[model samples]
Target: MNRFLLVILFLFFALGAFAMGQKAVVNLDEYLLSNTKSGYTNVMVEDMVFSWKLQGQDIFVKIFAPLEGWLAIGFDPAEKMKGADYIIGIISNGAPMINEHYGDNPYGHKSIVLLGGKDLTGNKEGLENKDGTMIGFSIPQDPQDNFHKKLLPGSTHKVILAYGADKNMKARHAKRYIIEIKL
Candidate 1:
């Protein structure tokens, strides 16, 4: 099908889902193509096109990227991808996993801890595609210290994007991309 048709269909289902309590993950490809005149700057890194929107004192973050292995988005870390607050996701054994990690320097304190949700990794909510998977979650404007730092509005935060991080051992993100944004 044509891209336009795909996006229209996506919006249809997504709107229905939103009516139910859960919001939908906006596909990166479709969003970029449709919103050519958007106010937000384009944030496409590697195979991932980051999409974000503000709603009710919360910021919704989504990563639509092909998962050859895994993809991650880190917030305010000590280094590029070190000692950061991360939302890491992957398909492990046919099961989709979105994990919340607290990054510690020297790669020794990487812990899979809770990020203020019942599930450590903000619920597994997103869409999957042949090109890649769209893994998404949300963070409050003002988060607790467990998330490493407070994310207040009008403040800028630096995030590192990485693909193919080793899941078994301490996460070492490859093909890392770093960028800063203001909420």
Candidate 2:
């Protein structure tokens, strides 16, 4: 009986931790296809265009921009990139790739931490425009990582849309804007 009690206690704590983490993993293709989500579109000064759909706590976003190199959409940009998260989409070697990163005010390796890398192909997709590539992805309304900023529903936040020449994210961007998200 004691051993069974201990096991139950352990499971309870583990489940609690997972729920608090707020990771909320979601499949991009499944979420988009399951809902008849009306697209909410936004445009930046640099012509980097994006649209997002919100269903419950899931947010599906797609970004398309004119870039000789790469395009990115960042969330919660303030003062710098100190407390912002961004997903960069690039066409590399005739393929579409996605990288999740968090900015710590500066745009460099030391200031940014990578979360995950994704490939846009098959069911997980977006159209690649001639001028730029489109990347479709999904993130939670509330991120699990304590290091990232929180995305609140019905409330807008600062956003950054940028593009640069280097795939390494080292080049000076052709355009960068600290705009507001259309929440």
Candidate 3:
């Protein structure tokens, strides 16, 4: 009787596992056929573009621009940005991180935040919140530590206003305005 009982238990567990496998197969098929962006709630497939903004603009989600300040940008983490990249224009610095066209490319890396029901493909370089909000400042790869320190944890703005840098590692000679983000 004990052996019979053991056989029954084993069969029950095997049936449960089989049921789970069937459910997984159904969900996978639905995901690939679905059109709505699930915010990456499903699998971690590569090379998909998702975009959102803090404030709406023709370009990226535009942030605050000031006469005596700099451009700051922020966005939501719900956007699945697997293949997307960002480009930030600066008011200061010659943009050593510029592209072949000598244009500023601040977000050359993937900046997707995986909160708010999203999964991460690659880690982004900035502050991320559990609810999928991201804040990033457009600065050169080698900037004064003061600049980075200024963008510490609780800062409300993401970009700054200033002038472009000169050949001497100083942004004192050029007028720079514009922070562009490519999705």
Candidate 4:
């Protein structure tokens, strides 16, 4: 009878530990949703949510869209898409990937590395779930690149938010918008 009781207690503790572990693993969508009230300025455009916070010399950004494809944000364009600095995040091959890009013309963009510019992207993360896709990343306020613009805290700038319908980066955006935001 004592051995039986011991076995029951061990199983109970094991199950409790397993449950705790599951709770400890955070869902990316839940984390991004929680940040809406946590020092992040959130903007809702259509079905997308753009959130950002400036901390020290770096700006942290999070984007949540109801798509399973790629999401991107462009900082200050010259004309149309010309001379814009873009950061794109996608879940490729079941993993998160980020790439820095430069708008070379009025209608298109290419990778910054391919354009002979240094990559300025900081830590990036992406996740795709039943609800949607979420991407979070960080970039310096002053990237010191010709194609990128300085993001001053008190300045207002034009930002472009776009997302595709699939994971193909070369595909056209399913939806895009331009908005003026004060950093």
Candidate 5:
């Protein structure tokens, strides 16, 4: 009886451990596909597709552009590219990298880290295929940074989307678009 009880207790603990290990992991493809199907606002500019959704206090964004270079989105530019916050995504050696940037001038931007700001992005994902490159990430609606504009739901804001010709970020964008989106 004692041995049987011990075996039963062990089995119960094993089952509990197994359940604890079953955490959900979301990959880049899953994130884009799931959100696309679940009411993400999608806009097509030329050959690029920009999708965004606001969940709770954070906004998730996905950009798909037909280029092998860096893709970027700028929020609430004061004029041209000035006074805006930017998120740039690149795939290097099959790994995804996301960078936060602040628009320093009408034609240029610098990394947020260089300007003494933190990277307030999460859940970054990227994929490069024969068709195009797709990148996704999430950021808080109010990042509380001087460089970043406050993004509010139900408000319309101007956004800039661009992509380079190659993986070099310093190179000029091959194509650019400016449009207004309602969050």
Candidate 6:
């Protein structure tokens, strides 16, 4: 039984069976997108920006790495807000279907826009890359959710970071975290 102690007891049970089939961190924070969106009461997921135009100077940014918390913008006459939040829902092509509590006067709705708010748990602030590596958010960008602007000029927007209020979430995309913008 001494072949180097049987390969060190089979590499200690194969690294304890790969750490018990991994997946812990509370099921990866219950599959991100801020725990399935809606009017985040106070979950505080500060920033996430994904701008567009690469071969042309306007390549705006933000998004450093698996960030899943900090967002506290406001307005909810019934769009409601509470814990377990993070909701962005915009769908505009032919306009008129704005829901975040009466949709304001934003008029046209450009390809789904709904970035959530409320969750400043003691003001921590994490994601920030500064000069280009993305991850930056000092808020401000909701001019009535960026008023449509020809359904978003130079477009290619299809973002989803959910949980806020679920709404079936279309099979939930395992919690939805896809921010790819090319405006």
User: After TM-score superposition, what is the CA distance of residue 141 in candidate 2 from its true location, in Å?
Assistant: 0.9
For model 6, what is the C-alpha lDDT against the true structure?
0.29
Best by TM-score: 4
| lDDT, residue 179, model 4 | 92
The TM-score, computed over Cα atoms with residue i paired to residue i, of candidate 3 is 0.20
Model 5 / residue 24 / CA error / Å? 23
C-alpha positional error of residue 50 in candidate 1 after TM-score superposition, expressed in Å = 1.3
Candidate 3 per-residue C-alpha lDDT over 1-183 given as tens digits, one digit per residue, 9 for 90 to 100: 699999999999999998876522213234333412422212121211123222221221212121222222222111221122233223233121221111113422222221112211111222111212122223222224211212222233222222223223223323323223323
lDDT of 5 by residue, 1-183 (tens): 699999999999999999887643434466457767987877887778889989888998888888678999999889788888999988887678989999889989999889888889898989886556888899999778687777888888999999999889988799999998887
- Tens-digit lDDT track for model 1 on 1-183? 999999999999999887785434446656676434443345777666776665565666777566546777788888545667777777665566777777655453354543343223443665544456666677666666555556676778887777763444244556678888886
lDDT of each: 0.64, 0.62, 0.26, 0.84, 0.85, 0.29
- Misplaced by over 4 Å in model 2 are 1-38, 109-124, 166-168
- Model 6, residue 28: C-alpha shift (Å): 10
**RMSD for each of the candidates:** 10.0, 17.0, 18.0, 4.4, 9.4, 14.9
Alpha-carbon shift of residue 95 in model 6 (angstroms): 28
Candidate numbers sorted by TM-score from highest down: 4, 5, 1, 2, 6, 3
Candidate 1 residues lying further than 4 Å off, grouped into runs, are 1-28, 31-42, 92-95, 112-123, 165-171
Any residue pairs clashing in model 4, and if so which? none
Candidate 2, residues 1-183, lDDT tens digits: the string is 699999999999999998887633333343344333455444435466666766576677777665446777777755475556777767666566776766655663222343343222122344443445567777767766655555667778788878776565656577778777657
**Where does model 3 exceed 4 Å of error?**
14-28, 36-103, 106-183
In model 4, where do residues sit more than 4 Å from their true spots?
A: 1-33
Candidate 5 segments whose C-alpha is farther than 4 A from its true place: 1-34
Candidate 2 CA-lDDT value: 0.62
Clashes of 6: 31
- TM-score for all predictions? 0.66, 0.64, 0.20, 0.81, 0.80, 0.25
lDDT of 4: 0.84
Say which candidate scores most in lDDT.
Answer: 5
lDDT of 6 by residue, 24-82 (tens): 34222332344234212112233333322222222212222232322112222112222
What lDDT would candidate 3 get against the real structure?
0.26
